[model samples]
Target chain A: MLHVTTGAASGPGREPILSLRSAVFGYADRAVVADVTLDVRQGEVVALLGPNGSGKSTLVKGLLGLNSHLGGEVELFGTPMRQFRDFTRLGYVPQRHTLSASVRATVTEIVAIGRLPHQSWWGRPGRTDQRLIDRALDLVGLEDRAREDVSTLSGGQQRRVLIARALAAEPDVLIMDEPTAGVDAASQQVLAEVLARLAAQGTTMLIVTHELEALRDIVSRIVLVGEGHLRFDGTPADFVLAQRRQQDLILAHEHHHHDDDSDVSQAPGVLSTPHGPLEQPAQKRGVES
Target chain B: MNTLTTLTTLGGLPELLDYDFMRRALLAALLVGIAAPMVGVFLVQRRLSLIGDGMGHVALAGVAVGVFTDTAPVLTALVAAVLAAVLIELIRARGRTSGDVALAVMFYGGIALGVVIISKSTSSTPANLTAYLFGAITTTSNGDLWVFAVLAVVVVATTWLLRPRFFAVANDEEYARATGMHVTALNLVLAILTAVTVVVSMRIVGLLLISALMIVPNAAAQLLAGSFRTAIRYAVAIGVISSVGGVTGSFYAETPSGGTIVIVAIGIFLLASIGTSVRARVVSRRHQRAEHHPHEHGLGCGHPAVAHGDHVDYLHDGHRHAPHAGHYDEHDPRVHAQTADESETAAETTAETRSS
Candidate 1:
């Protein structure tokens, strides 16, 4: 479970695991997340924190090629993202089970699927593949329920299975989309502990989450996004300070801003102040969106 | 009437193998039996169950084109079905309409066009057209068996080889693509396979009844199956049993083979549903008993984590625990409606079934 595997080696001249320069992601002809640039060094746990629909998930999907890339260059493991073909080097955990409609695979079968890209079209898993799958289940502490249908698992446990499936690939960088959304507290803590263990073992991670409850202690850096813009890229402590500053700015400019209660209360992080110091947190408002 | 009685008296199991026509019908049934349901299980899982019906109508149009041109019906059906499959995929990828809506439009349009073409064609007789639409299993030729054999081999080999990829794509399309799976190509391949399967299976069950052969057995199997692998196996078993039984039953009853097979499959589905619901009720009762006596473990309970209550210690960091703790039971109605199979399996075995 705590194997010292090679992570994004970040010393002196080591290249970043993922680099996105002015990346623009969207659907059809519109850009949802525009001109975002960031670099993820090896073994560093980065968290993308934002209110709903702030493009944090879209940015991650753009890096993984799941979203439409309107413009910009993305590099993975020092290779161009488009040209990079070694899929086993990277792993991704999607938001939730709602998207997987027809899948009724057993826990073991779902975990075993993590080994698909590593094997040939018709070849069964080798001994090493089996061992990795087993280790992944053990890592998630789900080895006892390997044969149960994935639908049978609780919400939090299902999230763990997804993480286990990603870990089964033994990837260098694990990118997760809202890994703890709707998860119970106990399961979230277990997930936090598991991820912390992975980070300690030199695993690179990029997690997209709106809530910063269980992950507060584990994250090395935080990236704040709002209204399709990269608002702040700094440490967790700095992120808290920036929030306080934004709150103060909204209070000072209350009469001039003339925004609604929710909007004034939940303005975007510091970087988005260019938009008249009143970036409408439309998504966070309970009634507006 | 005497001759009919004679045939019925002689129509035992061995009598099916005696006639060349019956032998050919049985061979075609066996091939269609395994291929259709195997493909259908994936379709059902993907929520594309009606795609089979859509492809069947497209195949009927191909048959009409063949009748008009005096060409091979099966070959023309293959072409039309493949084109229609590609068209459906195109409409689906456009994302303007829901998949079900797109498929419905195509389904009705193809059948309507086929009917117009058949009515306009001079060479097509009413008898022949009726046979094509409803199926004439007694007229199945050796050449038809060869076509079925080739289709069966292609469908089985491709599905088996790409099993993992199919599962991944069906399970989560975005995650599969993120994992570097060529999802577009795989989707096209799956559509093509479905088109071919639908076209070939049409001969045994008729274009009108083809989707039943594809959907009903798998739906029943999903209800009864313990896992994905077992679902496939169970679907195949149900398919084979129902088809062979239907063919045999048809000969004795002097009924249409296609209709008989579909009806028998439905019967099996009803039986499976009844059995599953009964089991669900028993499991739910057992769970209620376990809930009352918290310390006493239920008989045959398999959820080890719930049993040990290990997760109760999980809120160590002052994280708010779920409001519904200590209520995780096999028969919990909320959990039951989500998946009844979990409760059924949990009520029957030790936890070791999965652990080992």
Candidate 2:
């Protein structure tokens, strides 16, 4: 696991940056992420992990207000999500490079767009904005390619350009859908180093990722979801140990059954359950596990 | 006959400046040429290039309404086009239908309704409609010129002021929304601007060919431009050249001004296609050479001209000095490091369930 000190754990007075209270969120027809209650504190790097179709991304989208809340409440920076206007305080990096290949923008131009929320109406970028943009580019090590067309860059370089764009906003809390998807191993290591540096600098981050290989070391907490429910929310080490225990239990159970002499047909006759419990079988299984 | 012979005898260009009709037509062409392509570049970038055509058809219906109700066609066309633009935006926002589908429904419906409305009006003859459809520059009034000039200036100014914001919204709407931009409002503003530009451009290129004015110049410019700013400049240049040349040629050839202008724009697009393809080949070759022969060279050197930006200051400095210059290797440690983070993030983002 990665080792990094973050502000959320270090400071006793750390405030919650975003909170979702029993939030039920989804499209018009259905609530995909239901009854989700999560609080992200300042200077914390929280990773959302889950299997496919587990509503982890949906919950994150709900927190971002991309999906409307069917019920419950969501707040950003202590204000209600709907009323929150300090967007510059929260930077967002989407899953992929959504820009079409036909776009005629350069890396600097793309990064400069991150300054939009901070800019005044009809105002161009001043010295401060330029400095922030340059700093962001420098952070991602893309300052040298600032003038190159974004389409000319490789996928990984383009991803760095996007991160630079998000960083240019100088956000207090950065929410990335997935910052390392489709990237090579070396890039992941660099990303971890950059993120480690940012964590040390006290910039909070909420990242959603499937694999915990590189990020397991940097993240302060892991929030896992399964089947639209919050399955686990704890430290990275605890989550990893619990995951290993779950696998070990399943393997041991399979081994024990294999060693047993009784056939499956005879076991079914011997182990009988009442029909009344069928309605809540999944819930019961969840509790037992 | 006398004017045509006079135009032909006196060098085919200078004598045309003496006629009032020719002067008005040329001015109208010049204004629409600059304005149409300017707005068109943004529309094309936004992937709504057909919005201009849809609005033109809507304006045609407005002209028919004006003819039927005994009102100024231009004024009524402006009103209808703006209303249609807003409607298009609303429909697009609903996400029930694709943008192109919505535009097609509007374009064909408006033109069909226009034809029906014109048939009902005794005063609206086929010849009169044909003039609106194909453009009769000789009939362009001073009032038309003034209105076109003012609207053109407004469109150009608004586009310039909101260029960066519009590009942001156009490039990645979700990102723009996350950044706290009122994306819907910006889109509405774009729609209104497109509507106004379309209606005014209709005066020169006519409804049937207005889309050509909006899309062709921008398409040609995109093939050659190094940046959006340069694209706008190139698009406007192509627009002015094509429109003015077409108008002048129409006077000498005695053909429909709008049709001639569209033809010229197509010819320019063809020429740009060749230039773009040749440049693409040269760039690929340079990339191959760089990959094979790894050497420490300045950023501006060894790279193809297309790869070098239009920044004159950078070119002057970059050509002389090598800053962090290195070999072009796909497997560079830095590249691998960058790729690892990018793919992991992408994979993670796609791993979980999404609602919308």
Candidate 3:
């Protein structure tokens, strides 16, 4: 489990860094993610939670200006994504790094792509590129493997390397889609620390994960998305409270389920006449916070 | 080895450097060397190797028509080839046939039309016929050299200017389109470049081996080079060596000049493939050993309590973490057999239950 420390507000108390207003986007005719409205404020880490086949990836892409919208608007830093690419202000860490293994690229060379927007049309990367790349490497705890081939590293290390690449761009907001998807426990911890540091630096983040239980502690806001709608949106505490209530309801049903199982064990044997009741539930729930 | 020796004997050809024949051959090879691989990088990346093949045949037909007309062959070939390329692009958009299949259809149609034109034309002569199949340096005058060099410069410059769109489409077209890049427009540009490249390189690669030049150089680069930029440079390097060697080697050998260049390029390609095979073997062996041993864990399984990421393990935890821990022994023969036995037993029970 990751320990994400929450601190006092910085800069604006509640200025939206990333916003999507009633946005609708997906394949033609059939919409996968529809009417999705979200506002991620400065210094906030929003954890999006959902079941499989959920619209998490679609919603994120629409907000990042990587996917076309059927309707509605997505604004980054108050300006719409359609106006200009705004490539410098936004950083994207895709769910999968679409790099081929045959090409031998080092961690530094890969990270240098972050400075692509800033460099002149014909200019090569200079000292500033080196400094930013080094900082990003240090941020991800992969500074020791700076010169190492990116493909030679393990899956977790590769994910960290991608994060480093995105961070090297020095964007105000970092959008990561399932950052810890294929990482070991130790690497997940390291990733959490890096994200924590970025959040502290006032970089707004929107993270998508199926691991809702683990995400509950770190997320300032939890949005439950499914079937082209924002099903639930609230603070992490409220989301947890709702989850607890759901657990109680499920537990109550579980008691009845176990009683029926025991009845199967009893079969035609009758001890019911003396007890006066046919069955009794084993667990008492809906009594605690 | 035989080809290199023949090419190196450029000095023994009775003061060949001063001769116009030697200059034309050298110029043709040098110009094609710079241009072929520059267009080749995109062709190989797009997996449209056979598009070059189709365009070459189209150019050959155009050249044949030019020969019979007693008109300018180079200009006629260039315009006709570009038109044929646009037709190939249209065919691809319709998705009726695979690119290779389309190339074969075009290739046969081109040859049949060319043969018919030559048979009927009274203008067909020994000089006209010689330059048609096996390209000759004697036909490549000073005017041809200027056209070749200018075409090469235009191809290289236009390609460099559109590098980002080229790179994006080459990597993934659907993704590129989503980013608002006009992918169809970019694809048309690549096809036009292929057409232009083949026409300019006619004197060097000729009609038969033009595709080989485009594909071979990129294949060499793919073996050892790491990035797209490095691959382009490596491919161009191999292209230059073959062009310089093939054209010069023609001064001595009885073989067709285009054949010699392609063969040299193929030799380089063969060496690169061999290197890649050895590398794959080493990589797979290490991957196998890693799979067989749990002690060789590269990283710890984040969910320690979960033995395997089966349905039950996922059900046990409230959080569904997509883990990075690679399965160690999933492919062991003994384990596989046991699993087969277990599944068979479950199947038998289900059958018995159905009967009941």
Candidate 4:
């Protein structure tokens, strides 16, 4: 058994950056994710993992107020979600497909958009804003391509540009939805390095991903969801151990089924290796996931 | 023929400027040229290129209302267009009706109502509606010119001041919302700006063809500009040239101002398209020709060597050059995927012969 703490036990008096209590998230009262209790403290990197149709994405959207809050309490930076207005403190990196392909904006122009939250309606970018934008482009290693049109870039480079846009805001907590999805392997490695560097800087991040391979080392905790409920919440090592045990149980049950049935080949096929039933649904929504 | 002879025999531009109506027409055209594309770039970015046409139809209804109530046509048109702009934005924001469908309904209903109302008005004539449908810039009064000036200033100043915010919403509304921007408000502001642009341009470019002045120059500018800022600059320049040139051409040819303006804008667009294609071909041909370099690039050639797929390329000057069988082959990463590999040997032979 693992001790599932509401928030990370890094220090005694540290407050949770994001807290949800029995949160029910959905669209128009049709709940997709229900009875979810989670808390993220300062400087903790948490990965929200779930299969397709498990409502992980809906939950993240709920936290951002994109989805309907069916019931329960959600808080950000110790304030209630309804009363919380300091949105600049939170940076969101949506999926790369969210960017419209028709826009003819330069890399610098896109990155400068992240500074809008800090700027007044009629104000231009000051020296500090320019420095931050430059630093963000530098962080993504895209300073050289700052003047090029974003549509001319490859898919992975465009993802990096999105990340640079989010980082330019200097948010206290960064929330990314599948930052490595649909990216090539080399770009995935680069994205992982960027996240690792951000983690080293003590930036709190809640990354929603189904696969943990790219962000395995950077993720401090793992929260697994299945069928719209929190199935497991623990350290990464404990989660791995739990996954292994579940795999062993499936394999042992398949062995018994093999003996009982004349169709032995079908028994092994029932138990998919490595991921088993928990990770199978991820491939169901291939276009989106 | 007579106007053409006068244009040739006299100093045409200076002589034409001597008339009061000509001065008003030129000023109105200049303002429309400057303001239309300034608002049009964002409309094009949002893919609402036809929204200008819809708004133009609505402004025609406003003109009918002015004729029916015996009021200034420009004022009533501005009022009607602004209301319709807000209504369309609200319907779009509610998400119940799709945007293009709403715009279509507005377009047909507006023109139908405009024609019906104008036909019933006692002061209306078919010629008055014709003048609005196709512009009669040479008939613009000083009062109409003053109204155009005010509306043009409002459109230009608002689009310039709120360009970044407008771009953010137009590029990606969800992303702008995530950044804590007031997207709904910005969208309404954009819609109102579009309405103002439509009204400002209706007298010079005509309500029927105002969208052309708003969109064609932008389309032409995008072919050559590498950035959005540069595109806006180029689009405004094209808009100014097309409108002024069209007005001058109409004076010489005895044509309607709106048709002449749209044709001039289309001419510029065709030129830009052909120029872009020719420039691309020229760049590729240049890249195909390899310069003669006596210094061989290798492991210790003092130049940085980058590992390409299965081969090494040496960075020289600004581009990379890979050593082939006997000569250096220039490797442009930008067009690497498009250029065929079989032509390398033939180009190398050409380079060798030229060097010899």
Candidate 5:
């Protein structure tokens, strides 16, 4: 058996691609995202979903090893995340809001940052690197725009360039944060196709977003995050089951109240719903707000 | 003109080479030229430029105390400046007040301490100690020159050896910490670098305007260059030009070398800023033309270097809010004008995913 030790951690032949245990995000002393345990297995497509300020972004950053605070342990390839320097191996398509817009780099140039760890600092990319970039661009269907200045591209196209950047690294796992935001329909379709293809090829991916319905086709599992905590984790079918159960409960309660109110209206003294017969959904006609 | 040239800026150069005063001035200025901007890059990026000014003032108090006690001024000043800088860093690390607020506190406190010491002293010459406040390049000594050379070498060596680490610190401190970087050590190093730069530049840019040398050339460089290396190149070039030109101007015009250096630097900055604006306009026009077709992503900068909404710049007013309130991150719908499906796709992604 081949044995190896990776940066302050030990692992067997097969170790987790990524893991987070009791991670917390904070500013100074106050925790913003607290005590989260999560893991992503190879070839799995998991989506982090939440409302505004629900810690999805923090969790993503933490998983990427970009967030500073973690309460317990975070690991990549069984190595302590804080000690890992090979960020390229963990292909991250960062939020569009984070990239510096003033850089005059081309689309190919942006993609090439994905190769930073593989090359020495002083060495410029050569033909082999260019070939990799070209292949990555081809994968994203943006081969024609490889050399074009990235700033001149449409919003949808820019998003493609970022994804292409991530793809260039050929990582076993990909984490895309809000990749579909501000993208066009055609571009979204292309992105979905590419990710679906990547999944078929057996690359693990974790995509975090506020909305998940559009990704239903590609994502195998759903993880709900709120208030810095993971509230749900399972297949999309389980999520659908939960949603349906909630709706059924609401409907049954409403029907029972209506029957009580009708009976009371007719019998004069039958006014009983325990707390007064769920009165007509109690919704004001013109004052719903 | 000859006398002024001889004693004004490079005022002491001949004597410095042949005598002590000129040597101190020459060595000190040379040390300043290299160290200030090199270390200043970290300070400016961290938005702690005023911290340099505060440290310089803190050193001034140390000089005053040295004068009163008849002690070696440079040693006393270094001790005081470094201590004051450490205190400022501690206050800043607490993350309670803005860096400038901490700087202001350290600034007044250092100066007051120095004044009180100076007032009580009888043996020291008030004029000699006072000159260190604004700096007197004319009175630089042989011993000071050697001290400067050693300090300069150390500053350069440390900066070069720690480039990647400092860059990580300056770029994002939080990220630096997460990546297992010794962020605390690096931050301490950065503060020390600022202290060293201030001590050296006091003879050239003056304690009153030392931050200008650190701030102006870099700001001008930022306006002109799109990358970190280019920005530093532009900044150093501006620094060199201002140093050479300011020395010449002060020699002929009979002004203080420190003041003249700052003036020349500001002139260069204004010129670069003007160039940046004109270039921005032209670039925007070209961007509009390219993007007008509606099929391209145009240029990243063609959209203007606006973050959230207002431009990515800070002011001296102490507030960090942007000028564009609601417009920040407000994308123009027509810019990409996507189909309902695409819009719904992301909206669906945001709405439907409750777990991941």
Candidate 6:
């Protein structure tokens, strides 16, 4: 439905919309993620992948100024993070499960919240806002459910409502945290299609996801994090190849130890080395591809 | 029998309105009815239903200050309540202590301070304090009505004008902040608005029972409303009915206004709860009856079958019927018309089913 208004800087050679260099994010004085360097260019769909507590969420929260920006040279739209005032350029869809169950807002009411950045403090929804809200709902295929209470919707439908809410802002980059998490397969496919449509319309996206299989066709790049560190940055094909090679190595190592009685003692070390070597081959495969 | 005789002697609603004091009390109650629940809806949405009670307690201290200083209690209460509101919000924003801890301290401290201050005052008796605590709505002066009117207007206008922003913040503070909303400022404004509501309602509903007026009607509304806006509308309606009815009943029965109003509000809440359960039963019974069918339509049954979510829906007599959990659910075609793409799938499935 072409709901997202394409930004002017949607081509190659455009300055990165979000840039983080030696960034440290945490709560209070403790750094949960440190020394991370990443750049998200215009029109690129980047999937942030990591294990639990890998600090991927912390990094995304840091970008939104939600976490403690302990030490960082983060930039949004070429403006320094601290100096950036144009938040309307970014749309955030938090985890669907995070939506408070107590709220009795309707689908339309929640979607209308996306327009707040563009609205004056005291202004009501104007004609333009309503049209955009409608288009957003249409894009997510939720136009008919606009009047229904959000709590009545299934987990997946609620996620779409959140996506529609984000899309109503017409942001330059849509940042989602585990949009597919806890969502059923059907809803995941629907979300993938919605995201793919947005990507085709030249909208930039930074999605934090563990289910890369669902978004394999849409994600342009993959960023892997482990132990609060950036571990891998490459294309989806490279990630797959690297993952296969790591599995093959583990298999070969297991075969070598099949007859050995002390294999259990060395298993932890062998598994720990896989993450370190994952980066080299993935980067090399990126060049080959 | 005594109560019935008193009611008869007091005459009707028109006779009650004949006295200036009764007129003032009713007008003040009407304003409280409108404003309290309007603010209460947001508080209830945020799950801060007891914050109003805390603000009311703090306002009691303000009334004590007013009495001790020979000033208007409403004005002093407003100042004290607004200050307490701001202080509590700042404490919450600091995140050093949890919100409920702060609320508990404020609630107990406020009433205790008010009682202590009142005990030391030689000019006013404990009876005067009782009037503020339990509410003597029948004794409302013209000056008090004017204050209530102005404060009510402020509460209504601010809430109406800023409803969207308030809802956003209350729903998801982080999302609102990410969207560049001045969340802290909005929260402060809401707290201040809540304080204003407390002061505005305290005269008619009483400081001790003001929270019930703010919360009970909204709670009742939530039982029946399908949306936030509707919940608000319903709550306001319930608030008005309860407050006005309570005031009138109290006038004839010679009972405490605050207790009467709160009881009426609770009564409505109970009725709403019962109504919701009854309606749910009726809807489920209808669904059970509609689920019956003479024939089972499935694959190779000579019916156009469309693949729905987890089951296949067979088109029979122009209605899509899907077997679900041993019952044939009559699927609404209009709900399935979510997108042209889905409808295309349904059409293709129907054609494929017929051909096979």
Predicted candidate 6: what Cα RMSD to the true structure?
Answer: 6.9
- Per-candidate TM equals 0.83, 0.82, 0.73, 0.83, 0.69, 0.84
TM-scores of chain A in all candidate models: 0.85, 0.83, 0.80, 0.84, 0.78, 0.86
Tens-digit lDDT track of model 5 for B147-208: 76787688877876665566546654543443345678878877887777777666656667
Q: Model 4, A151-191: lDDT tens per residue?
A: 76667678888889889999888888889898767667767
Distance from true location, Cα of A15 in model 6, Å: 2.3
In candidate 6, which residue ranges exceed 4 Å CA deviation? A1-11, A247-275, A278-289, B1-11, B96-99, B288-318, B321-356
Name the candidate, 2 or 5, with the larger lDDT value. 2
lDDT of 4 at A223: 77
Worst 10-residue lDDT window, candidate 2 chain A: A270-279
lDDT order of candidates, top first: 6, 4, 1, 2, 3, 5
Q: Ranking under DockQ, best-scoring first?
A: 6, 1, 4, 2, 5, 3
**Per-residue error (Å), model 1, residue A5:** 16
lDDT of 3 at B209: 75
Weakest ten-residue segment in model 6 chain B by summed lDDT:
B347-356
| Model 2: interface root-mean-square deviation in Å | 4.9
Off by over 4 Å in 1: A1-12, A97-103, A245-272, A275-289, B1-11, B98-102, B288-356
TM-score of chain B of 3: 0.75
Better of 3 and 6 by DockQ: 6
Candidate 2 stretches with Cα past 4 Å from truth are A1-3, A6-9, A251-289, B1-13, B98-103, B282-356
Please, what is the whole-model Cα lDDT of each candidate in the order they appear? 0.74, 0.73, 0.65, 0.79, 0.62, 0.79
Task: Mark the 10 consecutive residues where model 6 chain A has the least summed lDDT.
Answer: A266-275
What class would a CAPRI assessor give candidate 1's docking? acceptable
Model 3 Cα displacement at B346 (Å)? 55
Instruction: Output the number of the DockQ-best candidate.
Output: 6
TM-score, cand. 1: 0.83
Q: What is the Cα root-mean-square deviation between model 1 and the actual structure?
A: 8.1
Residue range A1-96, candidate 5, lDDT tens digits: 111111112123346688777778765566677767776666567888766677788777776666556477888888887677766677777667
